[model samples]
Every structure is written in C-alpha cells, then in structure tokens.
Target: MTKKIRLADVAAVAGVSTATVSRVLNAKSTVATGTKQLVLQALDELGYERPDALRDRSDDRVGIVAPDLNTPSAPEYIQELVDQLSLRDYAPILLTHSSAGGTEKYLQMLVKQNVSGVIFLSGVANESDYDVRRYLDEDERQIPYVTINGRNPNIGVPDFSSDDVGAVKDSVRHLYHSGHRSIGLITGPERFRPAQDMAMGYRQAMMEMCPDTDQTVLHSHYSVESGGRATDTMLDLGVTGIICGSDLLVLGAIRQIRQRGLRVPEDVSVVGYDDSPLMAFTDPPLTSNRQPVRQISSAAVNTLVDLMKGGNPPRVPFTFRSELITRESSGAAPNQSQF
Candidate 1:
C-alpha cells in the first residue's frame, strides 16, 4: 500500500504552519518567496501531489496578445505559435485588442488573470507610438514579456525579428537581375523600424544599380489603399519595376496598374514582402520575400520559458533569415524603345 502524505507532514518539513502551506499551495499573494519555495520543495521531497491551484500557475498558462486577429499575417503566425506551445504541453490563451479602447485594456485583463507569460504580436504595445511603460503598473511590468517583429532598447525583454534590411536587398537585387534600371519602392509609415530598414536598403540598392537614375521611393501607411495611390505616383515617374513592403500593397498596386491599361511583368514587374496567405491564387501569383515565422516564434517562446525558469536570456535581439519566393508577378524588364 502507498503511504499517504498529509498537509501537516509538508508543513512540519517546511518549518511552517499547515495554514501557511495551504496559502502557498493556493497561490495566495501573501506568501513570502522563501516560504513558498520551502513548501514546494517539501511537497516534492515527500512525494506529495501538489494542489491543482498551485500546479495551474503561469508556468502552465501562456498568454498571447495580438493587435488584430482579422489580419491574415497576424493570425497565421499566432496559430503557428499556439501549435508549438501545445507540443511543449503549455496552454495558450489568445487575446485580441481590436476593440475601441486598444491594447492597454487587454493587457490589464491578462495581468488580472496572472498569466504565465505573454507574447505580443504586431500590436500597438510593440510600436513606438505609445510609451508601454505608462500602461503597465509597477507589479504588472515585472512579468516576463516577449515581443515579435519589434524591440525597445529601454525594456529588458527578449525580441525576435526578421532581417528586414536583407529582405529589401534581395528584392532590389532580383529587380536589377531582371534588367530593371529604373525602380520604385512603396513602403510603410516612417515610424516602423522594419519600414526604415527597408527604405535604407532600397536607397543603397538603387545607388549601386543605377548611379544616374533618380531614386524614387514613396512612403505611406501599410494598407491596400495607400499602395494604390503610391503606384499611381510611381507610374507617373516611369518606373520599370516596383518593390512593395506588403502583399496587400502589391495587390493595390496591381489594381492601379491594370486601371491604367498596363500589364504585369510585360509592362512593369513587381515584388512584395511578407508572403501572406493565398498570394499564389492572385491573378498573377506574387513574388515575395518570406519572413521566417516558425523560427522567430519558436525563439520567442523558448526565451520566455527560460526567463520563467530563472535563467537569463541574451539581451541582444535575435533575427531570423528570410527567403525570396519568385513567381509570375516579376519578369524581365522590357526595352525602353518597346513602349
């Protein structure tokens, strides 16, 4: 017969009262750090089964916060992260901040629930628009956090991102190889680091490809509408090839090009970043740079787990590689005399 270990036995070994042990097992905030550790150690040593409440702490419940689940890219990556977490035996709870109030409200809800850890995906909290410190309370701010695709030098949290600069370089290089001399770029808002890095890459590539042609780079909000407007302006400048920051933007540009009675690849070639869902099903399959979503998400989750286990993760940012996927949207540039 197996021996039964009682609460009093655990309390005696931990040098605390049974009531104190109960509080610790229940995850009451009043328990001191040292006392909680002692009780946990005692339970382990005595082969006593830990209470359900204590076992269900944040080490088991991981939180995922996203800006908008409606977006194609955000949801795809979130699903990948959740699948990885399930393989690790962790329960992932997803929260959205698409309401009127914003991410601050969702963050408060997570803190109140005492989640194990949090992963922020393309949300305003990861952006520079708002001071993240202002929204977090003193205690809540101390929780383990990880950001994807963004970073803050001031905060000590781990960040996983893609090589935005390298992606842009690859896009420009492809256009150059296709005999595109006069290239145009459509990018996101100036505040985003990825946008800034891509813009720099485009400028550098343009200078290297054609030293005399005027560099035509347009900046706009990361949306389909902005892409259409930017394409109209680039066409006015007589560009032979265009590089867009997103698939949605590329779609808009394609629409604008058709409206102007121009053909894709034959008249003007285009490249896009972020190989979003159903890109291949477009009228002309998109050629894009694919961000390594699986690699980045795994790195972020593993780093957060290390932090929770009292381990110090590297303070520097971890960047994953991106690959260029060529498709029908891009082709050899036509001769200037062909027009």
Candidate 2:
C-alpha cells in the first residue's frame, strides 16, 4: 500500500506552516512562487506524488509578459494577473524580458508552448518605436492578447491603461493650489505612451495655471539614479514642486533633496506615480497617483480568456483614471529656496 501523504510532514520538510503546505497542495495561486517551489521540493523529498492540479498543463497556461521584474510595481501586477487567471482555472507562465532577451524570444516560445492567450504588462508593446508586428504569427495573423497600461496604435487589440494625462493634470493642479508655481515633471522616455501623455498634461496644466513659467520637464529612465540626476536639475532650476513618473523615481528625488540639505515638503514638495506597494511606509509617506491595478488586471485576464473562448471583445483600448493619494510628501510650497 502507498504511504499516505501528510501536510504536517511536508510542512516540516519545507520549513513552513502546515497551512502553507495545504495551500500548495490545493494549488492556491496566492502562494509565492518561491514558497510553492519549496513545497513541491518537500513533497518530492518526502516521496509523495504531486497533485494533478500542480502538474504541467500547457493547454491551461496563459502567458504574461512584463518588463524589468526589479521594479516594485511588477510583483503586484504579476500576482494580481496570476490570481485572476487562476480564478478562471488557468495557470500563468510569466516571462520577464531583459536586454539580453527581448520580448520577441519569449513571444516565440509562448507560441511554441501553445499558450491559450498572452497579456502584456508595460513592455515593448507600449513603446511607439517597437513594431507591433512582433505580436503576429508567421502568416501575419495576430495572436489573442490584451495589454495592460499601454497600447500600440498599430495593433487593434484590446488594451487597458491608466489615464496618464489626467493623472499629471491632477498632480499639477494640486501643486498649484498648494502655492507651487514653479513645478517640474520627471517621467520616462518620450517613446513610451504614458510618458508622452504625461508630458502633454504637464504642458496643458502649466499653461492654464502658471502661464508665464517655463514648462519645466525632464525625461529619464525609470531608475533611482536617473531620477536623482533629473531632480538635481529641477532643484537647480529653483522648482518648488516635482512630480515623478514612478515611486522609485520619487525615492531618488527624496534622497537627492536631503543630500542638498533640504527637507521634503518643506523645501521641495514631491509627488510620485504608481502608488506602488510600500509608498506609505517611506520616511515621509509618498503622495502618489494610485493606478487602478486590480481592476485593470482583472479586466485584462477576463478579456483575454474570453478571446481564447472565441468571444469577440472590441479592439478599442479602455482607459481608467487614477486617484491622487495625498500624503506627507506634498505640502504648501515653502518660501523661495536659495538656489
């Protein structure tokens, strides 16, 4: 007779609680990937057979392609996408693209894997420079897919993105009311649609509120170091408020502000986008624009799954607005700083 598999035994081997082992056994999508791997290894070591649900099923797999996983927002997007897919009885195969292997390689692999559908999360698909042809098959037939938070106009696929223009406009108006006339904008490269929208909003808002002031804007990579350099320039320009593209950039700006012996809000009020996880925990909790992450992820998964089921969703892109979360990082503008 085969020995009965015990959750407690597996938990002990995996160095986790039995509840965690149970969740893994039940194929719960909420478990972290690393924890799930450890549980599977524990089961193997304990001579237990794997659950049918945990077995490889390429037919049940949906591909999720995303940019740099190092970004703080990436994990949240991944987890939400995975959970939504799993709720519909689909498993997710995550492919994170890097400079060494662009998205083309992963898309080709997903094609060969026979994935049911694909969902893009803020990647080359959103950049105007990249051709949407990469998403097509050899005969030029498009694959069933959905994009979250950016779209290429060349491809008529279902897309869900935040209202980047409105977000920046709101941020600018907020700063203007706070007595900041000289506000600067820091965002990603112009090639990305979100950044372009933000730039447009910044120009529009600046024209409306501070007509005479120059439309101060700096484009930078979504990295801490790049954000710091951009902030240095804005500080030198004597801007009283700064709006950054991402929370990571805001962190860099905050650090740069301190290094200049200035206090956040007191010397240089800052606002961040993506109100990503842990923003509220920063030294001065970030004031940020909160993207509707869960709503967008759920919609993307549902739409893609529907497409896989032969249901036709409109090819038009859907845009969602963002909420400005006021926090400690933003305040009434201080007296003109000695630049």
- The global C-alpha lDDT for each of the candidates, from Candidate 1 onward, is 0.80, 0.85
> Who wins the lDDT comparison?
2
Task: Encode model 1's per-residue lDDT on 1-339: one tens digit a residue.
Answer: 445658799999999999998888666768888998999999989987766445445667788877666454787789889988888888888887655256667666766676767787763455632444543324422457788877656665678888888898888889999999889899888777678878998888878878787888888977788899999998988887999988878989999989888999899999998888789889899999988898988888898888767688886777788899999999999887233
Q: Pick the candidate with the highest TM-score.
A: 1
What tens digits encode model 2's per-residue C-alpha lDDT throughout 66-112? 88887767889999999998888898988887731865677677766
User: Each candidate: how many clashes?
Assistant: 1, 0
lDDT of 2 at 54: 63
Provide the TM-score for each candidate, comma-separated. Answer: 0.81, 0.80
Worst 10 residues of 1 by lDDT: 133-142
